[model samples]
Target: MFRILAIAALLSLPATAYAEKLANKLLGAKEVASQQAPMPIGSYAKGCGAGLVELPETGPSWQAMRLSRNRNWGHPEMINFLVDLSQTAQRLGWAGLYVGDISQPRGGPMTSGHASHQIGLDADIWQLPPKRVNLSRAEREKLSSIPVRSADQKSVTRNWTRTHHELMKAAALDPRVDRIFVAAAVKIEMCKTAKSSDKKWLQKIRPIQGHDSHFHVRLKCPAGARLCQTQKPSVNELSKGGDGCDDTLMWWVTDYLNPPKPTKKPKEPAKRTRHPREYTMADLPKQCLDVLASP
Candidate 1:
């Protein structure tokens, strides 16, 4: 009876615990090229990259931040897109770009910060343009990105600028960019200020949470990446049409910004006993293990 009870208790433990253990083993590895052909496997949020390349720390029109994180890796297509985008931004009269996290060496669930960016197709571009191209590693760590949203989060703050809008428009118009995520306030401001012709590209600029300091750019699946997975179609595919400045935009300002007070005192929330879901070897493509094991 004692032996049976002990076995049952062990079986009841959350599967995520085991998944995290295996995931840790892979996450600890340094970025390396896989012996296999360069291919992005699975979806952006739940996938991995096989033959990844590192973005140079500094380029003519951009500087990559957070050097210590070793996250400046991506598929070749993504890296090329970023290089072009930075040059375009500089041509548009903005200062050089300040690039942020791209993806881990062997893309998968990261140790912290972000649920997507697992396929080397998503990147974070800092709101503050780079002051200089030759930023030392120490300066990159200390430099802070300015916030564009107001304190109440209902409107654009004083820090917001027309150049910011121009920068986003440039990214949105790029054929390579599938979509860009920004703060809801930033979207609202764009709607009010964008010219009629510029409004067309606004469809690709999506509003999401916590993008006040930077914008996220995701690319469509690259050609020849047969194993790459695409996200399920959203009810309203932004690329097709719809400026997205309708009731959906209002919800962020009204309902999301200020919720009604509770009628009665709420009970204390229960403590979370279960571990949060962490991606494991099972969650990624089978090829990912080989990618991690590669040279």
Candidate 2:
């Protein structure tokens, strides 16, 4: 009993130490400012300079890590971005948003995008009610479909909505958000709602591909964090008003869920039939003797 107690005490110390380090990293984070009321997606600090924080290093663990695709937390930039989001939610009279996962240390050893989440700073946000919240299935679904405004005050609803547009508009008011990965239609609606002042802010955001399965919020890293990695915006990255988000749901439904189209085979040419010859006996020659014997 004494030995067990001693081991438990020792284990608790490190956990406490780890928690403190993480709190410090998050507490001191800062956000970039947007001059416009409804800032554009990229108007907020982007890439690696948005005061993003990371989960602290507490050494190694012996437990096995699990892997799953669509279960990755992007980077430190995401942390700072969420902080701003949570605060914005609170300021708008809504309950603070829950951050589901961050900094998958095992990379996707047990999950997908291990390379992206390798750093101790990235995380995932979900509309799923926090386990403590105990929301019913219907309630959860409703939460997931709540439509929130994009920063442009446009009625852009994410793939997963979680409340009113005011909640999203309030979150966008922050300056730490770098960009948002939303549904194509949502992006289009947002661009339309953008006011002249909001346009200045909206122009900075670059919308990329994403699923309605979940809303991905990425942020720039905070100052002085070396572990934070930078994601280069893709060449295909584009803003609103260009081919209208260029969405391709066709591949999603056909290639992933629908059966592949069958390939057609070429038909073989038919063999031509020849008319029986009247002088077949002469044509048979020596072979005719063998045929006659067989008969």
For residues 1-295, what per-residue lDDT tens digits would candidate 2 score against the true structure?
A: 5534643543355654633332112211211211111111111111111212332211111001112222222344554456566556555554555444443222211222322222223344443323233344344334432333343322343533434234445444556544455544445555555453544343323344442333455444445544344456544344433222233233323443364875878568788652221112222222211211220
Please list all clashing residue pairs in model 1, or write none if there are none: none
RMSD of each: 7.0, 26.1
Worst 10 residues of 1 by lDDT: 2-11
Query: Against the true structure, what is each candidate's TM-score?
Result: 0.85, 0.41
Which residue runs does candidate 1 get wrong by more than 4 Å?
1-20, 238-240, 260-277
lDDT of 2: 0.35
Q: By TM-score, how accurate is candidate 2?
A: 0.41
C-alpha lDDT score of every prediction, in listed order: 0.79, 0.35
**Alpha carbon lDDT at 88, candidate 2:** 60
For model 1, what is the C-alpha lDDT against the true structure? Answer: 0.79
